[model samples]
Target: MVDRPLSLYCLLLPSQKMIHRLLTTAVRGLSANYRDVIYYRVKGGERLCRTPFAVFQERESGKLSPKARAAMSPEALRKQFEALSGKKRATYAAAARKNRCEIDLRRKAFKQASLSGFSHFIKTTRQWTDLGRRAKEKCCAETEKIRQAAKVERDKMVEMYYSGNAVKH
Candidate 1:
């Protein structure tokens, strides 16, 4: 027989405990997605670097995060704000004052508008409000129907498992 490492021989004839561990690890590996395998292979089994979160220390050092990069130069920042309409410009300014992050000002305006039932965002026309109300009612009805169907399916699954008649994967 050709000379080989003792560990190679041990691996070829694994113990019962080792067999169980090997099977468990194999099953876990088999369950992984094709995308995961490809990504790991391409990256040489190394994990990607994690994004650096902006802490108070970084902010105090006068370093701008990715989101605030556009507002670096005063001239560009002035031009950006000037381009916005009067109402939008005012909203952006107010959001900047309220949020220390100074990013996603439009998102803040939308959140405020949604919380107040779109009072500021929506037109003051009666017909528009009536249409919006009808749409909301329709959406609520559909949501309730879907929730009831899901509850029925969950009950069926529970009954099956408890009755020892669970479906095979």
Candidate 2:
């Protein structure tokens, strides 16, 4: 059996403390450099970078006409719309259809112009256009064909008294 003195056991303590202090100081220096060079640059970059959508929205909002701005409350507008004659309503519908077509044409032109920059968006737009609205609607309707049956089953289950599951013992 060997009895080691406390002072002998403490021989490596100074070297370990020096190593730890050096590592901590090195890490602190490296982190400070990283914060100054990388972290600050990235934080500043986010503030400086304006996304394409943001730029588009800014320009689009600037193009809004004063007459196009709605002054009436939504309720007032709804009442006005409801009070309109069938002929006037039909006219409004036609105008809305024309406006929608114009907007679609503008959007298509914009996408074509920016196709070189946003190739991914063009691919996605092509995929979406490949599935027409009627096709998508029919697919969704087919998928939801059992919805009514499920609702009826739910109603039957909820009416536990009428459902013959009661114990007769």
Candidate 3:
């Protein structure tokens, strides 16, 4: 065995210690970049990022009558959306970001679960398939034996039938 020297920049945790990494946009972005990830403690709390899976953008348009903006064109709609983004943007950007990150995590988790389920089904069914094949072979062998016996009995009856018909002739 070769003795490897540890680097000064590396700090390793014990084997028994488990650190849970919460799903966050920061984490996802780091993953996307394929870079080493670091996380700062959340503001005012030690809890990591936990959020809802859905997000909806709040429309910032004022309560002006729908009668005015009903026939707006594409450019006009963009302008309206931009105007809404500037002034009345909701304070939920943080929550929405967290929710989006959670959605990404959920999608990843769901995909993993689906793959694992399919693999498990294939493994379990393989045994049943083997059992079914063996049973079929046994049944076919037994049926062949019965058919051979019936053929032998039929041949004996044919000779007896001919002997009785000879007396009638």
TM-score per model over all chains: 0.22, 0.28, 0.25
The CA lDDT at 4 in model 2 is 30
**1-169 per-residue lDDT for model 3 (tens digits):** 1122243112323321111111101133324211111111222212223331111212322343567546545476555545655323343345556645743543443333323322332323322123466665664565455456545544443343334332110
Best by lDDT: 2
Tens digit per residue, CA lDDT, model 2, 1-169: 1233444334535664354334323443333422222211222221111233332233333466656434434465466567768886665566446534533543343333322212232223323224567865654464354344444543433343234353221
Best-matching candidate per TM-score: 2
Report the Cα RMSD per candidate: 26.4, 29.8, 29.4
Q: Given candidate 1, what's the lDDT at residue 113?
A: 27
Candidate 3 accuracy as lDDT? 0.34
Number of residue pairs clashing in candidate 1, backbone atoms closer than 3 angstroms, sequence gap of 3 or more or interchain? 0
Better of 1 and 3 by lDDT: 1
* Backbone collisions counted per model: 0, 0, 0
lDDT of 2 at 86: 85
User: What's the distance in Å from true for residue 74, model 3?
Assistant: 3.9
Better of 2 and 3 by TM-score: 2
Cα lDDT for residue 160, model 2?
Answer: 30
Instruction: Report clash pairs, candidate 2.
Output: none
lDDT of each: 0.38, 0.39, 0.34
